[model samples]
Target: MIPYVREIQFEYGACDQVSPLIRRVVANNPGPFTYLGTGTYIIGKGEVAVIDPGPDMPDHLEALLAALEGETVTHILVTHHHTDHSPLARPLQEKTGAKIYGCAVGAKAGDSAVITEAGHDLDFSPDIDICGGGAVFEGPGWTLEAIATPGHTSNHICFALKEENALFSGDHIMGWSTTVVSPPDGDMTAYMDSLDKVKARGFDILWPTHGPPVRDVAPFIEAYIAHRRAREAQVLKALADGHGRIKDMIPTLYAEVDKRLWPAAARSVLGHMIDLVRRGIVVTDAPEPGLDSDYRLAG
Candidate 1:
């Protein structure tokens, strides 16, 4: 198992026959080229299912294939089509004869994928679609359920292992920084709904696509929900304080937010602002403007 930044180590197939699965750190396109993601491998019944194949890195792909040796990869499950999480689906499929699966929907216009803020392009059109909330993959002693959790991306899905009682929470929950809710592609309402959906379900271990696995899920979910609510309140406060456009609100709203990530921070703020407008918490001249528009909280 290779060790990378943030004390993350690849434990080959520790979860199943696919023991010692590597966590290859690929370059995140947006801001500072930081490393993110924990690609998982589940080898069973002479077939393998690799989740979130991660970015299109030749070395990373090679590492995955090398780890597999002669194992046959049956499916490549994507949590979302985010560039960092799912870009390698095609290539990995090509090499392993694995089928790619993600949300049935296609890309939407004006989505954050167009911005290219991250050096990596997250835009994708899946080969196989898994729309339903629960799709099962049974093998050996495990049954994996694909649970649709749309919020960070419209097509995001989390996988749950019935036998282990673990949920492979893609970006829906991460150990590192908070997941970004970029507009159009990311919906705050759906995000909150999805979080509730997962929280309602009983699960012990959370195998997030990024960062380490969360052993204590209930508290984590509560903290995540509270954090989001707090962020919304902060956004509202910034607007009430006379901060207008997303750009203007960034400095005060995310004062301690990383400067290099201000662009992403702005996108998340836009998502909140849009939600606030729909809820009548904020007033705007035009519902959805191209750019540079003022926003103020409703009196």
Candidate 2:
């Protein structure tokens, strides 16, 4: 089968108007992983707010500034600390004199800890680290309330747009591809819980950072949760049927997938393995099960 496909039709450097209050500028960093680069969302009217400022690239920053030429960027909010998701917050903050806000970066390590997706900006310190809900940013005919949906990463946040009844779903729930749950930064348990948290919320549509907007919110979320459960069940069966290592188990689980994506697929399998280990259903040869660790069902 082919590798993971991205359905969103986007061109880098084009600021397309998605709605009455939202204008999206796609960055020139598209790849197998990033899809059609990063979508830097310009929200609100005259005085607007930017979400997920994208990479701190020269052209992307210029595009963002040019998008808000006459308007002032009052605030900049990022969903998480990933390079593609953030990094430009600092530059934009300096250019527009807006305060940057996001969750704290995952703790840095020296190669001893479990692997996570790389290139997190540790220097990003927000003037006000929004503690998810209870805080609201009100603009002209719009209201943005932070949703604490920490699944992709520990500090990920999805902003709920009150006026449109939509959500600025960052990497947490992208319409293009499933969010990668890489441990120890990503927790399958927390990821599943956050999906439930989002399901319980009231939102009509989702404007994800990577791909197109998900209009079918309820069914999409339900399918996402069900897919994860099925994956977990498959992992359990792999262990029960004498397959242990992630290398061996991925083929059985993702045989329809292309071989090139197995590495990324393995990371996701590791997430399930870690979740199983935590729940006392699986055990690994290594005390801390990383990408290369061997796993088996618990006695």
Candidate 3:
């Protein structure tokens, strides 16, 4: 089981210093997907770099600006173009003259793909594209290296803080719950590969945008990888046992999950189906493997 950090101590609209180089202000937008809301991080001291400016709430904007009263925001770094994570970036930039940096919008943006719980920020295009990873951004006393991790979204990126040995993980990995891999953009194969990639980096800690930091790095990541592999095995077994459609397998596969979240679970299952088909382990009749498509064991 993933060691989920369900409770965090912080008031809405208040900035709290979580580390020597990081101060976070949590946005007040909480929901089923967003644990306590978006934790917009300010890295460094004098000239700071903001990671994930969060939703465009007027109150949140005011609170964030208030927290950085005398400091200069040199770079506004986005993890992805999700509405909840990056909508406030442009507005913050307009106020601070900070350059926005992150991955480009997914090529499948505005397509017929199923919209996940958190929607896309179609209007967001980063001033600097750090999607391919290995791009470094530094301020007064901190340096952040962007690492591409696409699964939760095609363009998701994580920022590694060299000074703190921590990674600002967006939705790629969360401490509250598993990330929803909605597709046409979210890919299970890519997600698994990205998980392995992050694990190999061996960061000391992970500070996800929506939850508290993941302090036990290695074991936590191992659990995530194991959970996904186990889920795929269960999905394959369901297909072999005559559960061809995604909806048909949900009742048993996600028996512990709330009914309201079944839709998101179905999308994750579809991601696995697409990956299975690509691996020649499964076959589907639709032009692309999707939630409604019938999947069967490859002959």
Candidate 4:
């Protein structure tokens, strides 16, 4: 289902109680990446666990604090270290004295050349690094099963709520827009693998960090996998048609796409090219494939 702004009827700063245990406070940091806004969820009542505190904005924090007027924030769980998702965790931790948990040790990007500060929150380091194993965090009335579904970023994760039969999918899967797999941190191979990983779990619902909830997760995952596969096919066809550079491929593959989003599209194209190079399906002139690097079908 398409996540149009008109369909999402929630107002900013209002703590809409979605469930008996979960309350959502969406941040007003809407952008191309953050469709509508960042959804900061407070799971459980009395002693609750805050998921994705959203961007470091005073208003958003006030809204969260207001929502938890009589409640205590026990755990502040972050899905990833993206600026829009994790920066507010520190401030919330300072205020509520809640322990911060997230993927601390991430798979290193090839290089930080393509990385932007606006996207990555470099200062974010969790008190408890919940990576590697499938760690289950239990509390007063809730249990969050941490599943490491790294794709959008190396440290990316999705948490399944035992109480609700749902997964806080973070930015790994969103109904608003297709997850952007931009390198050097964004690996196309890892992303596709993670999609398969998430699909296998088969959760009842997926509440993304941005946009509306995905109720039909199985079909959605299938569609996601199919979309990526189609993009990969397009990249292959572009290579076959002798469009070597990522810039050329962007125009050819994403002709109908917005001009402003083409740079991001180029990065995604580079991601696909690098993945193809790794698979020996495509070869590049440079040792590491880049935006300017030339690519071709493997001999």
On lDDT, the candidate that comes out on top is 3
lDDT of each: 0.69, 0.81, 0.91, 0.84
Residue lDDT tens for model 2, 1-299: 11233577666787889998899999998765576788999888798889999987999999888889999888798888877888989988889999887777667412234333435666666788875654788778778888888767778888988888899999888787777877667778899999998889857999988878888888888888888999999988887888878888888888977676667688788889888888999988796887778788888
TM-score of each: 0.85, 0.92, 0.98, 0.94
What's the distance in Å from true for residue 52, model 3?
0.2
**Candidate 4 lDDT over residue span 1-299, tens digit each:** 33322246689999888777778899998887787899999898788999999899999999999998888888899998888999999999888999999988454643566564337887789999887638888879899988887768888878899878899999899977778787878778989998898889878888899988888888888888888889899999988888877787777788876676777778888888888898899997797788888889999
Q: For residues 183-259, could you state the per-residue lDDT of candidate 1 as single tens digits?
A: 67778888989989999997987776665667777887888888888889987777777777778777776787678
Question: In candidate 4, which residue pairs clash?
Answer: none
Following a full C-alpha superposition, what root-mean-square deviation does model 4 have from the true structure? 2.0
Question: What's the lDDT of the predicted structure labeled candidate 2?
Answer: 0.81
Error of 4 at 198 (Å): 1.0
